[model samples]
Target: MSRWIVVLAALLTFSSAGAQTLKVRHDHDPWGKCVGELSFSENGIVFSSEKEEHNWSWGWTDIQTVDRRSESEFSILSYADQKFLLGRDRPFDFTVLEGRGMDDTILGLIQSHLPRPVVDRLPEEVERVDYEVNVKHLHTFGGCEGVLRFGPDVVVYDTSHAKDARTWRMGSAIVGVWSVGKFDLELEVYEREGGDLLRTRRFRFQLKEPLDPDFYYHLRRKLVPVR
Candidate 1:
């Protein structure tokens, strides 16, 4: 039976080397987030949610690039193409995946399917952060209160008793921030027009209550990787 045992061991090793299933958290907006199992095979990756009816799989060749959204989350696939070199025919359709305990393992497994250059470009970890800052209305004698909500793709300035808030798209805006008087912050926005400097807007914010000490620090870090 020793020969039979050796054959069995070889078969088990081959099977393990060919496929693996890992626990992960899958996220795709509108469809929402769910805990699932991600199976890695020689051909492609298969994802199955806890719900019996939900299952999807895609091949490595179908992926363009993967974006890391957080330490445990990755935008694994996106589909888009240009037409006639004019502009993109359509926007990207993203496939996002999130894993907690198995993040590194899952990421490593995915990297193995990619080329060395692509694997080197992947981030070790990522974090998504956004917040609202309290700004003071300096134009008027009796200053009004305002809040600036900073997000990944947009920045919004809302004034108290205002009909509508002013919004700015982050893509075409260059913003410079600095610490001002005790617990106050200053923001200067240089709006761009077709790669040229357009106009500038300025605002000041005060931090009355102590929030995260690293709020400003983290904001700068987030902006660096925007491009």
Candidate 2:
């Protein structure tokens, strides 16, 4: 009927014939390791490390980050702080049928399921952009290198290795914004205590490139309306 319907049908057919169960070595930190079967389906990712006794499954929403550790290895960090390593040798076999490497394929699937940056959900009239910045959390003094994406109503900070990430909704979690210099900006956000804003914490970030002279000014302007 419609062009959109044709596109949707193609996608459905492709997905139904795509790769599913993959046998690889599975590693569970501090729990030992075993050869297991990993599968990707509509119900998220499921894995069976040892028969039916040691199997686990996680929905796409349960995953927090996926970091490529090396050319041949990657790690999945779940929201519960559990880490799973997959690769060709360290933990899993990368080789699959037709001499294809499954690492990249699996990675693509995971990335597609990750939450979009705040700017992505902005109204069409709002201008938004993404930038890489060096960041430091003031409370823990932790060095968190990541990209910052901002718009009129929201800001999302995501670490390079996906070690830490947060989406701050202006007026709800953002408390203050300060310009350190042409290249740096500081964001003060509310620290949550049992799902409630209990205190304020600061994070400092310096833009990776200082080409935009009015970057900080524009960011401040965006925050004002939302705050």
Candidate 3:
């Protein structure tokens, strides 16, 4: 029948839209954790957990914000209040256990679907770059050496320090990027401070090589939204 055909088409659409599912683990407080499946689709995000109480199915409208800093880890900020935390927003943290850990592709998909901006830390995977400079990312006490790369849509710091190497997708991750001189560059971005609050995180880089002004202008231009 014609009605049956329409119904089948709708079903297929729903299924295909949610095809990118990942094996994930949900971590609870001090020492507790659970295995589950986390999926991001056109409809929303779904968590099929072994325990029923831990299960979640949130539409985009239900989310407060989302943070994806590491390739393997991400957090979903929800409006659900935590009584123990004085009615604060509850957060769901997930870690990719299988398949490609929330790479640039997945991050892009999420960014497109979400109505609001997500704190995206996963940098764009670029093969060719416009410029690269040897620099030291400064910390309170010390710093680490890395190659700061400027690509078409992303800026990345490739360092030897584990968990220190970061990629920032231009326009989204970066609040502002400016140069103090040929030997110094500063980048401003949003980072999760405590629970789900996005606070400003500034990365100061001391460049060993001179940064080209022309390259900086070209790269900074991309931050301006196109009409």
Give the alpha carbon lDDT tens digit for every residue of 1-227 in model 2.
99999999999998875646666555555465566666766556777776577577778776543444332333444445213422212222122323223454554565455542111111122246444444543335446566676656657776654434665666455767887566667887755222121346676776665625466666666666653
Task: Rank candidates, TM-score, best first.
Answer: 3, 2, 1
Instruction: Give candidate 1 regions above 4 Å deviation.
Output: 1-9, 50-54, 69-71, 80-102, 115-227
- Tens digits of per-residue lDDT for model 3, 34-121: 9998878887888999989988899888886687768889888887888888987888888888787877666677777776557655
Query: What local lDDT score does residue 170 receive in model 3, on the 0 to 100 scale?
Result: 79
* Root-mean-square deviation of every model: 13.0, 9.7, 3.9
Q: Clashes in each model (backbone N, CA, C under 3 Å)? A: 0, 0, 0
Give the true-structure RMSD of model 3. Answer: 3.9
Give the alpha-carbon lDDT of every model: 0.52, 0.53, 0.79
How many steric overlaps does candidate 1 have?
A: 0
Worst 10 residues of 2 by lDDT: 117-126
TM-score of each: 0.37, 0.44, 0.80
lDDT of 1 by residue, 1-227 (tens): 69999999999988767766656766544456666776766677677778666576668766543433334444444233445435432222223343343345655566566431121112221133277666665543545576666777556666653422344445434366666544676666653212122246565566554435576676656554546
User: How are the candidates ranked when ordered by lDDT, highest leading?
Assistant: 3, 2, 1
Q: Give the least accurate 10-residue stretch of model 1, judged by summed lDDT.
A: 117-126
